[model samples]
Target chain A: MEELLAEVVNVLVVIVEACGAAVIIIGAVWAFARFAWVGFRQRTTAAFVPVRLTLGRFLALGLEFQLASDVLRTAVAPSWEELGQLAAVAAIRTALNYFLSKEIAEERRQVAAEQDHHEVTSTDHRGSGV
Target chain B: MSAVAEVTRLAALGTGLAAVVAGALALVVTRRPLPALAVLLDLLLAAGLLRLAGDPDWQGIVTAAAIVALRHLIGVGLRAGGRAWTGPRPPAASAQEKSAL
Candidate 1:
């Protein structure tokens, strides 16, 4: 009876593990799709197109890698190596977030500079008007 | 049932209630859903981790912590992510801003 109960528990664990792996895959894919859509939307603005696209691509890659690590964790991990990989994946996500925000800040700064220059030029032209 | 079990159940119930109240208050107080959801997610993460840590495997603990981090990230991310809150803000003139006065 004890052996049978142990087998049942193991089976249940495996099932849950599979479910967890599937969840990570779905979540990562969803995140990547959202990132791509956001990138496409930003492209319409024609501002910071290159920086934004690069950042979005990096974020999507990070999400995919993180998802892969998450799936591997549930599949074969009850080990230090797998846990370390998961940790690294988490770190990469954090780094990706950091760079994306940096990109946004740079974009904002560029916009502000352009606006200021426009204002200055317009003011100078108006002042020089005969 | 058993006293410990009863108390645990009650604590769980209380946490649930607090979570709901916080969520409602968040909308009224901040008028935003994402931050409120993040707060609720964090609370749930804490409650689950506290309850499940004893029997947890390695993968479970890391996954749980990562989930909590994501919730926290959502809060900061949305703050920096710039939601579609752009609109005609209050004009510079206080006289213009004063609608009731």
Candidate 2:
């Protein structure tokens, strides 16, 4: 039963890790495609902020999956050496996850502020018949 | 597991290359070097995290940690620089510029 549990957990780790990788790939591809399309369409006037924000959201989601897999790995790691490696890996990922989350929040706030400013200015212009 | 790691490493490389292209495109679109740098570093961070996935050795862990640290340092620098560089834009002038655009 112990052997069977370890095997199941090992499989679960691989699957979770794969999901994380898939999320990153999809996000990267989507972001690149949008960047290229918008760059060509609007040239210098384009707003790449939204694109970057989307990519950031996708990356954060992917990191969450990767961290989950790291936690799952501990379930099957029987050796001290393996556990040490897992711990180090998990620590790095956790740090990254925290930073990513913080940046995403900051960027989102900035984007919202910019939009608000834009709207207010446009409204003022309309009021003055500019 | 080695094969898995190799594949993931390769994927990470591809993601890094994509980041370079995206960063360059952002530079062209925004005409702002710092924002482009931020985009590049952000994507590279994603790539580094992806590389850290799967079974990695001490070397891999160290490299990922370095990438994360560099990302944090650069981010702080960019924020400071952005504030200093933009320092109090006149609202009327920016509105005129937007209108012109």
Highest TM-score scorer: 2
fnat, candidate 2?
Answer: 0.64
Q: Residue-wise lDDT of candidate 2 within A36-118, one digit each (tens)? A: 88877876532677888888889888889988998888888889999999989888878877887888799888878878999
Positional deviation of A105 in candidate 1, in angstroms? Answer: 0.9
lDDT score, candidate 2: 0.84
Using lDDT, give the best candidate's number: 2
Best model number under DockQ: 2
DockQ, per-model, please? 0.02, 0.53
- Candidate 2, pairs of clashing residues: none
Native-referenced DockQ of model 1: 0.02
Residue pairs of candidate 1 with colliding backbone atoms: none
Model 2 quality (TM-score)? 0.88
Q: What does candidate 2's lDDT look like per residue over B1-101, in tens digits?
A: 66657777888899899889988988888787887887788788878877888788899889999988998999999988877776898899899999999
List model 1 lDDT by residue over B1-101, tens digit each: 43333443344345445545544544444456664564355334333322221233456556655764675577567656553354335566556668657
